[model samples]
Structure formats: structure tokens, C-alpha cells
Target: MRTLHRREAAAALLALPALALGRPAAAQNSRPVRVVVPAAPGGAIDVIGRIYATRLSEKTGSPWVTENRSGANNTVGAAEVARSAPDGKTLLINADIQLMAKRVMRAVPYDPITDFTPVARLATAPLVLVGNPAGTPNGDLGALVAAMKAAPDKFAFANSALGSMGHLSTESFKRRAGLDTLVVSYRGTAPALTDVLAGQTALMVAPLGSALPHLRADRLRAFAVFSPNRSAQAPEIPTTAEAGMPDLQFTLWYGLWGPKGMPAEVVNALNAAVREVGAEPAIRARLTEQGADPVDEDAAGFARFIGTEAERNGRVAQEAGIEPE
Candidate 1:
């Protein structure tokens, strides 16, 4: 009887390991996924992040939350996400400025390429060249380029930050056009746009979504759009390429990324969730309303896209003599 009892006890102990392994890990799928936005609450980046969060939650059967950590031109939030666990739970709804331009500007806490894995490309939008409707001398791209070329140092352009995408795009324009113009850097886009509209600044380059309402209301004049093609939201406006400047093609994009080395299953699941959410009719409408084109590329595609962007922007920065701030 004793020998039989010992054998049964040993068998029970061996089965215990299998039973524990069969059960779900503690809170692995239950914890909420965090989506970090590197911009302020009322900005386009925040809006995009929120939309993704909602759709991801619905598709994944898990709670996804958007956390705004706006500072350092979006580096703060981006760094936070880069340092997070290599799990799909923490994600960054990163803008081009944070993911691409910030690295060129200064030495950040994390590596943009090696530290994070790209999950999906969310949206792409044109950058609009806008000017004060009242005092601006030029009405169109040709006229503006001519005016700047005629008196190089006389014309002034305002930008949100020194090394920001808008600033770089404007610099590219200047270099390609062989024109010299003064650049004024501001703390943020809101203040810069306010100054431009108030006629305090001659011109500014802003994303189409931010410039659309003003353009439609006639508060500002649209000079040229920096995009491969003209925007559907404002089809009447000509693209930079159409304006006789093919070299000025640049688009502001946003995407999702997490820390590198994330589980393959988790990455696939997140990619599917983003694709589903981005394709939803309501989400599409909302993005279209904001003058953004929704994109839903998988991890490899997004990674390749980001790599290309980084190389392109790096060249622009080097050619334009853009020094790190």
C-alpha cells in the first residue's frame, strides 16, 4: 500500500506542471495596451492616436489607451515608448517629426532605428505653404518663388521649430530654387500660424490638415503643396511638382512602432489590428476629413518606408547645412 501511494504521489506531481502550463499567463492579455502620442491634446497627432486606440481596442478585445506626453518636439513620448518592454502592449503613434527629424536635430535618449520595431504606417499628408492673405506679395507658387529669387534676403518664413519637417521642407525649397530667404523659428505651430495669419510673418509651411480650415475660410493663401500628388481634400491646389518644383515633394507621415525584439505573434496581431482599424469606414472618413490619407502597411513595409525616409531626410539635412540643435 505504501509503495502504491508513493507512485501515485509522484505521478500527481508530474501532472501539476502540465496543468499550470495549460492555464493562461497572469494578465498577459488582460492588461491595457498603451498608445503614446508625442503631441498636445488638440493636435492632429492626438486625434490620430485616439482613433487608432479605439479601433485597436475593438478589434483586439483589449483596452487600448492614448497617453499624450507632449514635449521636446515629441522626443519625450517617443523615448518613453522606445524604452518600453518589447511587448505589443506599449506602442507609439509616432509622427514623422519625432521618429525621423528629432534624431537629426539632437542626440536623443534612444535609437530611432535599432531601439524600436515598426508596426504600421498610419497616415500621410501634404505640407501646405501658407501666407498671410493681407500683406503677402505673391499669390501662387511661381510668383512666390520669383519674388524670393528677386530679393533673396528680404522674404522671411516662419517655422514651428528649427530642425522640424516643415523647416526642412522649406529649406529644401530654398536650396532647390536657388533662393536665399530668412527663417524664423517659433515654439510651436499654433503661434507661428497665428503670426502668419496676423501678417506678422510673411509665410509658413504647415501640414495640410492644420492649414485646410484656414485655407477654406480664406484666412490664408495657399502657395504650394509639398506632396507627390495634389491633395484630394483641396484638389484645386497644385502640388509642388506641378508648381515647377519636383524636388520639393515631401509629405508628413505618421505611424505606429514598439520596442524592438517584440514577439512575432504580438507584432502580427498588432499589425492586423491596425490594418482593420485603419480600414474602418468611420476611421477612413475621419482621416479624410482631417485631410490625411490613411495607410496600412505591415511591419516590414513600414520599416522599409521609415528607413527610406530617414535616408532622404538625412540627405536633405546635410545638403541644407542643417546643424543639430
Candidate 2:
């Protein structure tokens, strides 16, 4: 009995170091993590958030749940996360929209660059220019551009919302391509795609993952992708440069963020967890299959990337002629 007691005490002592580090113990004992995704469920951002949440729960042995607080081009949920206690319990999973919100909105409650500490950049998906095949008889980009130039006001373009990446990318395309496509904004990607399918909207620049199904079904036509190279998922679709618009580049990127002042230990632990999970072959393959390239950047690296993105996207917003609303 004495020997058994000693062994038990030793085991508990061994766990003390881990508990102090706050990896498995903190998450397990704390309230369930609330991951806020500033977009509607079923969109690419939401899907990526769910994946990371599930994997994070598995890694830390904690229950992580996602809450959709979509509105104001992703500012609503972002603001919520920003206002949350910086205990690492509440997190935000968002994309480029977070950076562009300030540029296009008259006033955003939270400063995306300073209000949160970046944890990791999960994945990035290139945007694609798609249209209804029936409406766009010429499937190539050049043909589509010529058609739009021929009759500028006759055709309409759709985007998720005014301050969204879709909106920014399309606006940039119009300016760069010199096409006078009218803008049609929707509450979310589903409605925007719905309008496109119904032919109410002629074209849209959206994430390739969301548009892949329709493209496969032949309901929509993919003219060009915005990436520098053709996507493995859809090699048939040429790149924008190949289609004569090399300067047009926009990618839908997803990253994790916590309220400002989260402990460095917690941030480091979460960053390591994301990188470990992202390195798994199965997860990598799955993200790739969905037209996303999983990125393994840490907190500092992601923060720097966000800075660069903000600067570049700011230029995009200005050139798009989209005034703050």
C-alpha cells in the first residue's frame, strides 16, 4: 500500500508541470471555448473555423464551439471577439474581410490590427471569376471582357457584400479590366451565388472552393482564377494572368485571433497546436481538396502578413471607388 501511494503521488507530481504550462489542463478545466466566425455558416471561413475548432478540441481535450455573428462585412463578430476577455477562451476565425472593413466602413468598432493578437494563419484560397455558362457563351475571360466592354451597363456583377473581399476583388477587376459591370451585393455567399445561378447577376469573383461544385455541375463557367498559378483542384481553369489580367490578385485567407492582451503562453500554445494539426497529412489533403493551401505561420509571422495585407487591401479599396459606408 505504501509503495502504491508513492507511485500515485509521483504521477500527480509529474502532471504539475503540464498543468502549469496551461495546455491540457487549462482548456479542460475552463469553460468551453467560443470560436466566433464573422460569416454565415457553410461559407469557406465558417468551414475552416469548424475544422480548426474540431482539431483544437482534439489537441487540447477541450470543447470548442463556433458562433456565427455575421454582419457589417464581418465587423460584428470581430468586435465581439475584440471585446471578449483576453483569457484565450474566446477566439475569432476570420479572413481578409477583417482588414478591409475599416477601409470601406465609415467607422468600425474595433481596430483589426490592434484589437486582437493574431494566433495563426490557417489557410488561403484563391478567388475565381465565374459566370453562368448559358449567359456567358464565350467561356474564356477575354471573350467575357470584350462582351462586357461592348455593353457595359447591360451586365451585372455580384459579391457577398460591399466591404467583403468578394466586393473588393470584383471592384479591382472592373477597374483593371476596364469593364463597366454593375454591382449587386448580397447578404452572404449563398444568396450571391443563387442570383448568379438564376442569371440575375452575370459574373462574380469568389472563393474557388464555394464555386467548384457549380463549376463541376456545369451550372456556372469559370473564366479565370486570381492566383498566380492554376489550382490543382481545377487545372482546367486558367489563371488571371494567363487570361490577360495578371495584375488582378486576391486570395481568401483564414486566420485565428484572440482578444488583445491574451497571455503569451496561451498564444504560443494555440499557435503550436494549429501548426501541428496543419502538418498532418490528412488535414493537409483535406484543406487542399477544398481549394485551400494550409499555411503554417506562427503568431508574429501572421501579424506581419496581416500588416502587409492591410496596406495592399487599403489600396484596393481606394482604387475600387468604394467609399466608406
Global Cα RMSD, each model: 8.8, 6.9
Error in Å for residue 204 of model 2: 1.0
RMSD after Cα superposition, model 2: 6.9
Considering only N, C-alpha and C atoms within 3 Å, which residue pairs clash in candidate 2?
none
TM-score of model 2 (CA atoms): 0.90
Q: Residues 204-257, candidate 1, lDDT per residue (tens digit)?
A: 988788788899999999988898887889998888888888878778788888
* lDDT (tens digit, per residue) of candidate 2 on 1-325: 0122444433322322333355566445545778999887777888778887887776666778899988887888999999887666789998878777767788888887888989899999988999987677565888888888888876788888777788888988889887777898776677788889899888888789889989899888999998899998999999989987778877888899988876666677678778887888888887876788889888889989998988888878777888887
Clashes of 1: 0
lDDT for every model?
0.75, 0.80
Clash count of each predicted structure: 0, 0
- Give the runs in model 1 whose Cα sits over 4 Å from its true position: 1-29, 101-103, 149-155, 186-188
